[model samples]
Target: MASPRPFSRYEFLIAWRYLRARRAEGGVSVMTWISLIGITLGVMALIATLAVRAGFRADFVDTILGANPHSTVSYAPSQVYNELTEETYFSPGTIQDYDALAARIAAIPGVTRADPAVRGKVMATQNGQRGLGDVYGVSAEAMAALPGVVDPERASGDIADYDRGIAIGIGLARTLGVGVGDRIQLVSPDGAQTAVGTTPRIESYEVVYIFSAGRWDIDEARIYMPLAAAQSFFNREGVADEIEVFVRDPERVDDWTPQLLSAAGERGQVWTWRDAAGSFLAALDMEDDVMFVILAILVLIASMNITSGLIMLVKNKGRDIGILRTMGLTEGAVLRVFFLCGAFTGVIGTAAGVVLGVALSLNVDHVMAALNALTGGNAWQPEVRGIYALHGELRAWDIFRAVALSLGLAFVVTIFPARRAARMNPVEALRYE
Candidate 1:
């Protein structure tokens, strides 16, 4: 507040000279450039990796919730898991009137819609091909709410009216070598009990539509048919296995449980989308955290180069420090000079990394596509069992965190060397010169 120009200009000028000086002047050394580059790469890697992880988590959650409902109003059994099969138990003790239950749920606040459905695993055979898939019986209203239907027109009408038609995912359709209008045989594991023994219940269904649900698991193994057909085929007339409910805010699904449960009545129990897929989501988050910790070590290693370079710089500038001190430069000013030099590297490196990381993250999909084209193969394809594609999302907060971490380390490492340079004895330092 006293003088606007009270800050020392000499320190910064000297620091700038040191940063730009060539090897001949014993100012900027090879180690300085190496340190800068190392920090840049480390920051870039952190941003890119974190961005990809964030994108994947978001995509995974969206795909999972999109293909399925946010919450399901089902007859709660003793236990519940993600996988659904024909042999999976449906609690007979709960309300069998799915229509009434669904209506009740739909009337709840924060509830968007509800649709009754029957789900089970079945063996599908078409032509000479055979595949195992999960089949769902849903009303037209319910099917319309599902995600990733390439041709909604085909699925918009009352699916409950079709007694001989079925909708299948694109992957399942491909595997069975069937298309729209093609006939496929579905064999349920829950067989009929005759005098001889239990025999598999088989039925032929004509494929009326094909859909891509974005999720590999769903796309590869889900089929939809009329609710009445499913109920009849499964020998559970006048009852549905579950009622899927959509909410206004899927993220806060847990908050709406009490209302949904109350509407579902005492015999009914509810399962949110998170309940079915929470474990998988948790595993992804854990993997991302581990990757972050591992990548942070690389940044730490790069910071070491900054420390080593600063130490060397101080040693090389010992004679200069002695001369400057004798010329009335304060110890604090001497400390400032070296600190600025180190900070220059850290700041520039962080800036460059942020730019590079953002550009790379935004264009990663295009870059991978180009690489695949060049290689004539899908080199960048996701090989995980349930993952269908690679996704990327860049959060500014993540970049901020990475930048702060890198700069903090760089700043901390600079202090020791700067202090050593400041504490130098003028007489002893000049003796060698």
Candidate 2:
């Protein structure tokens, strides 16, 4: 008679029967279940972690770009920081023609908005409360164009008379117990010199608006006053401390740098957002790599359980393997049959994990809200998290990575056990039986 083809119908039929273990094979069945559960949990956790990491990074970068300038121009060297006020003190006429320089830069092709500003740190006082405030002196038009602030959704007051009043952060407003229409005092230490000494310049402006910049640090420390008012406050009349430049695409900072310099001419040098935040962005990338490595190890550990289970199955089925070999089954067919059993378990487990992980990512926010409500505590504060809502971004790459990791591990570990069963000595295996 002709030898049976590889993995013939009878071989599959026999493999299926063997997988449905009898009372004598109860221990093998338990091992199979444990292996399947382990793979499923590992894949699920890996995918979920990736989704959360991706979401967090995207949200953080978006907030940074939205609430802050993409680039800054000042009458100082590129190495000089944007917050440096000493540049203005040393070279009073370096950026004296700020209005014209700003207009020129604003007309650049990729430029969106170029707003002259004066930034300073001062003491804020209201209702007997005191806190340090980061004050920005910007024009009414620039203040209106400021992204994330003066928004109808987040702002509590109007900017109709912005020059006559100030726009403060909601966090700062809360801290100082001030609200729209209330007066808050800003005390600057850099006042005009007198015969005896310099006195603190104390000025109070009505709160025209209260805005949230979506960042706890910014919302807790920023204040926006009119350009002319800010100039006078900083003793910088007819000149701006610096000009903030927003672009159409922030990633094109390098491309726009030359054009910005040309527009700035001899007036000022360009300082990019990256100069201010590159280190922080690099740190985030490092964090992502670390998280991925840690979670991948979890998958590796979980997949090891498959090795134990398959070894047990091979040992318990030694007698059956001997009978099959004597009955004309090829060694290759025996290996294929056992391989299918393990492969089936891994594929099914991985599919179920993908489903569970995706579902969890999609409903993470709702889950967080439900848990917060059930616990009746206020631990998840936007001010603490720097974002108003939690988000999870599921990606195709994440799912593929999880599936490939699980399936690859399953196939590799299945090899030795399947080969062992195939190479069994029929006489020796049957002698024990």
Candidate 3:
């Protein structure tokens, strides 16, 4: 016979022929299909899981930082270092020129808006139910801008319309058994001293509006009123506890934080929302990493099927391997033939998995909504809502990483069996069959 055709072309053709052969023709076996299915399922799970986690984090973070300022500029007494315990005391002695300070911060390139606010704890009691909550003093104009925090559209009365009118969270209203036109008694934790000793400042505020920020923590434990009203009520006027700054890109708060802090000078300290929520966000990141590793193990387990299937293929194709070797098929070409068998399964499985996973991730919200409807429950929403609501978002990097991990593992697992086939002695392989 004339010289055998180039082994390169023949190697691929033979591998494809073997892969496509029916069981009757001693072709593609059940184990091959098992490996393909296993890889597809593994990759799909990994991609979808990671995408959901990423989406949940993005949605939750955005809801929080969007409703709140990206950073804050505060000037408190040096002795009050602990925010959790020490009350924010902005006495006239500690007060700074808020207008000038805000103007300076607003002048920053990335800074979009700056507003002064006073935050303090107050007790709310209505309809025999009582609870402690945080009260924020903000401008009516600023209140109109953040609907999640205080929606102007939903309010029947302006925060400045009434001296003691306030916007309350919807959850708080429910808990207090009150409504938009109801009155709630507020007792400031720190109030004026009296002959009876240091008594709490007590006042009544009409609930002009109710806001639902999709977070139970904020909705049930926070309220907002005009800065002027808060100043008069808290007995601290011509001053604010802190100046809140909003930047164009909240995600890049780090880039603008230092500059804003510098403008505030030594009298003020800067705090980004990220810094405030660092521990919670860090826990989320750690959870994502752990999930990735755990899901990656699923792909690794699936790849074992590729290894087993390839070994079985080599055994079944022993006689064919011997004949090919006798016909001048180089050992490397033999190795490549078996390698291609496993690689094709991996490639096809990974591609299918990626498509399915991405599709699921993109539409997961709708899917969840449907499931919840069917189940007659609010399964899609959080049981213990905090600073944000539940939502889904698919990131490109998540898919890329999932696909890379799956394919890389699939390709690596084929090496051992391919080498075994290449090292087989032609005489022994042929003698058995």
Candidate 4:
């Protein structure tokens, strides 16, 4: 053990004075400032990138799970041999006993709700404007229980009136230039059969409610109507196209697939949310990995600045180091002092970055809004991004990674210069001075 240990008061005091030197003192203060700023900005950029990526993922997932079913069980097409045609033909899938099937699914453990729904495409028109709409036929109870449909913040008009009228998405409302209590005409080509041919089923229903599902595609094309109304309109009075299943944990949907498949038997097949959005999610994951690697390289480049700063400091202080060594200062003490100088910059820069990164991530939407207001233009287009605003989320693990990266690089780069200072020959260092 030594009398004065490493990182002692005097070591730190000497490091502090060296760090605070002016331009006239051959201080290398300029390089110090530049390196410190580089580290700070690098860390901030890394944290902010992680937060934004996480936000995009969360936003994408929330919309998927909130607005769409975790899994869909639809009747599977079966091959039937027809004697009249003397050939086998595939019959279109339709759930004849939907009520029983939905009940069976709802009884399964971890299952939340099973809704039998009729789905179809129709042209919606109002005020001489027409847009294609995807209509979902669900019972009033199911509609009321839906997270996206019943969200108080995004939903308007009385839900109780939904039994008599129909509900529409905000995007559809915008397209038709209508609001709550307005009437919209739904025209479907697959309609009632007459002697001559099938006629289009055209019905006008008041838009009793409007909801935003936090997704542009869903909001623009989704419509909901009472089960009875949809059944009568679509000529599917006794059956549903499929059953939408909800569970306690959507992330664990694969775990429940076996149960769903077994319950469905040969009558139906299961389709999970993962199957619906797997490609997009995979792309996002690849993007996140690539972005992280690129930013890590940036951090390393920024950290190299620390090496530049320290080398300059060492060269300028060679004479001082030699004098200190002659005055009973050990080489270890010299090393510790320079190490402290570099370490201080890293610690302070990293701390500042953490604060700035967290602030930027937590308030990304607000910051974007301010920028949009200042520029008199919208930056986050909901139609393009599938979300209303930029979602930014800061995870503890991300912050830790950023801090570790900055400090680790700083420490590694400082070692090279610190060793050079420690190994300088006193005679050689002071010969020129």
Pick by lDDT: which candidate is best? 4
lDDT of 3: 0.80
Number of the top TM-score candidate: 4
TM-score of 4: 0.94
Kindly list the per-residue Cα lDDT of model 4 for residues 1-433, writing each as its tens digit: 5568778899999999999977675447877887788888888888999999999999889987877889999987889999998999997687889999999999999999999999899999999999999999999988987787689898889999999899999999999999999999999999989998999999999999999999999999999999889988999889888999999999989999999998888676899999999999899989988988888788788778777888888888888998999987898999999988889888888888888888889898898899878877567777878877786988999889899988998888889899889998998999998
TM-score of each: 0.89, 0.88, 0.88, 0.94
lDDT string, candidate 1, 1-433, tens digits: 3422322687788988877757574534777888899999999999999998898788888777767889887766544443656365544543477788888888988889888888888999988899888888887767767665534643333334345588888788889987778899999978798999888999988887787767777877888888888888877778888888899999999998998878877667888989988898899889888988887889888888877888888887889999999988778888888998889889988888888988889987787678878988465543353656666799988999899988998888888888999999999999967
Q: How much lDDT does each candidate structure score? A: 0.81, 0.82, 0.80, 0.89
The segments of candidate 2 whose C-alpha lies over 4 angstroms from its true place after superposition are 1-17, 77-89, 92-94, 265-267, 370-385
Q: Which 10-residue span in candidate 4 carries the lowest summed lDDT?
A: 21-30
List model 3 lDDT by residue over 1-433, tens digit each: 6654544676778888777756664434777787788888888888888888877777677667646778988875654345787665444323458889899999999888999888888899999999778888888777766745654553344545534589887778888999878999999857887898877889988888777776667777878888998987787778888888888888889898778768888766888988988898899999999989998998888888888878878887889899989988888888888888888889999998988888887788787778878988566555454633345567788888988998899889999999999999999998857
**Between candidates 1 and 2, the TM-score winner:** 1
Candidates ranked by lDDT = 4, 2, 1, 3
Instruction: Tally clashing residue pairs in candidate 3.
Output: 0
Error of 1 at 275 (Å): 1.8
Mark the 10 consecutive residues where model 1 has the least summed lDDT.
153-162
For candidate 2, which ten residues in a row score worst on lDDT?
85-94
Question: For all candidates, what are the clash counts?
Answer: 0, 0, 0, 0
